[model samples]
Target: MTTILVTGGTGTLGRLVTERLREGGHEVRVLSRKAEPYAVDLREGGPALDRAVEGVEAVVHCASTPRGGDERAARNLIGAARRAGVPHLVYISIVGVDRVPLGYYKAKHAVERLVEGSGLGWTVLRATQFHELVQQMLSTFARSPVMVLPAGVADQPIEVAEVADRLAGLAVRPPAGRVPDMGGPEVRTFPDLARAYLRATGRRRAVVSVPLAGKTYRAFRSGGHLAPEQAVGKGTFEEYLRR
Candidate 1:
């Protein structure tokens, strides 16, 4: 069986991918800042990073920071992979990163470019926003009996578990370049999602739509961050809330 290394193995998506790879009878190693199976910081490339990738057939890079520093991290990981002679490199990116003008989106686009230019067998999967993130937004933005959201928007959010499954599948196969975009089963407005969340939690709240300004508003209103036809996830927001 191939030895696969997963970066950011402690995070939401990375943990699921690690478990799936291990269950498949592969030697799964995790790279984290703390001492674990291995310790490697993608942001700082050095002996630790090299050691993590050594003798591994594939590298699933899930380690990413906020938009500003992600490109540098991607570059360092690519260099480490080249040094370790890892055959396959799989990257997980967000859907519509290129279409959105957010700082995080810009960083993700840069990472994709780095992987493409690295001259290695690489696959990139662009997935929609995770259900957990949406839930967090609901919790943070909800005020007592009302939830405020940007006016005029639609989102097809995917479950993190589903995205992890797809990432694990990509890790086993040879690099396929860019895979088909993955998204959730249903399209819901921001306010609707908030209302559903409140109802699921047995709380009564009014969904309020607040018009926003600037690039973030434009991006959300224009539906630049959604993947309508490409949605492949089975879980709905309600299902996620129920769980």
Candidate 2:
């Protein structure tokens, strides 16, 4: 069986990806900041990072932080993988990263570039936001008496497990540069999603829609982050909430 390395193996998406790979009978190496045997921080590449990549047939890069430092981590991972002679690198990115003006999206777009030009066989998959993230955001807003959401903004929140399954499938196949984008089954407005969350959790909060300013908000409002045409993900936000 081929040996594969999965960065951020403990995170939501990464953990699922690692499990899928292992189930497929591949040797999976998990690389994380606190994981045993390969407690590597990708932001700071070292011997440990190299060790994680050595002899691995492919690497699924699921490690990312929206707070910052993703570019650094990706650069370090690329260098280490190159040195280790890793043949394939797969990256997970967000939909509309190039269209949206958020700092996190910009960083993700930059990482996409790095993977494309890293001189190794690489594949990049851009997917819409995850249902968990949407739920978390709504939960944070629900803490306030009134939940404030962006006006006119729509989201297609996909299932993390579905994404992980796709990544596993990609890892086993040859690298395909920038595969088809993946999106959720339904495209719903922020207010709609928030209302669904409130109903699911039995929380009572008046969902307020505000016309947020700035290019990022405008981009979101214009549906830059949506993939209505690529709604290949089967899970819906309502279904996810019930589960």
Candidate 3:
């Protein structure tokens, strides 16, 4: 059985990946700052993270920071992987990171480039936003009586477990650089998602579409973050709300 180390293993998607890998009879290690019991954190490339990399056959990089320091973390992880001679490095990136103007997107794009140039056999899978995260965003707006959403943004929120399954597939196979982007089965406008959330919760709230300015919104409205043709996920936003 191959030993696999999953960064951000305690997070939504990473947790699924780790569990799936273990079910497949592959040895798995979880890496996260809050890691406990069956996991360990990188500690910014300290001994624990370094030792975790040692002897692992592959690494699924699902770890990310909310405040946008993914590039630094990616660099440190790449160094450790190289030193450990880890054969395959599988990274989960966003669908429109290269085109999106957001700061976090820029950092993720940089990490993609670093992995490509790191000289290790690597596979990069760019996926649309997870349903859980999208739900969380909408929940934030649903806090008040009036929900405000971006005027023209659209999203294809895929299932986190589906993405994890695909990542697990990549971990076992030979590295294929930049696979086809993964997306949800359906596309929903921002307002539509907000409305769905309200409907699901049996709440009556006036939904307001606020036109957001700047390059970030422009890219989002332009559909940079969608992979309509891919639609690789089995779950839909409606189904997600039901659960």
In order, what is each prediction's RMSD in angstroms? 1.3, 0.7, 1.4
Model 1 root mean square deviation, Cα atoms: 1.3
lDDT, residue 242, candidate 2: 100
Per-residue CA lDDT of candidate 2, range 134-167, in tens?
9999999999999988888899999999999999
Top candidate, metric lDDT? 2
Ranking by TM-score: 2, 1, 3
| Candidate 2, superposed: residue stretches over 4 Å from native | none
What C-alpha lDDT, on a 0 to 100 scale, does residue 98 get in candidate 2? 98
Model 1 bad stretches (over 4 Å): none
> What is the alpha-carbon lDDT for the whole of candidate 1?
0.87
TM-score for each predicted model, relative to the true structure? 0.96, 0.99, 0.96
Error of 1 at 116 (Å): 0.9
* Model 3 misplaced regions, further than 4 Å: 36-43
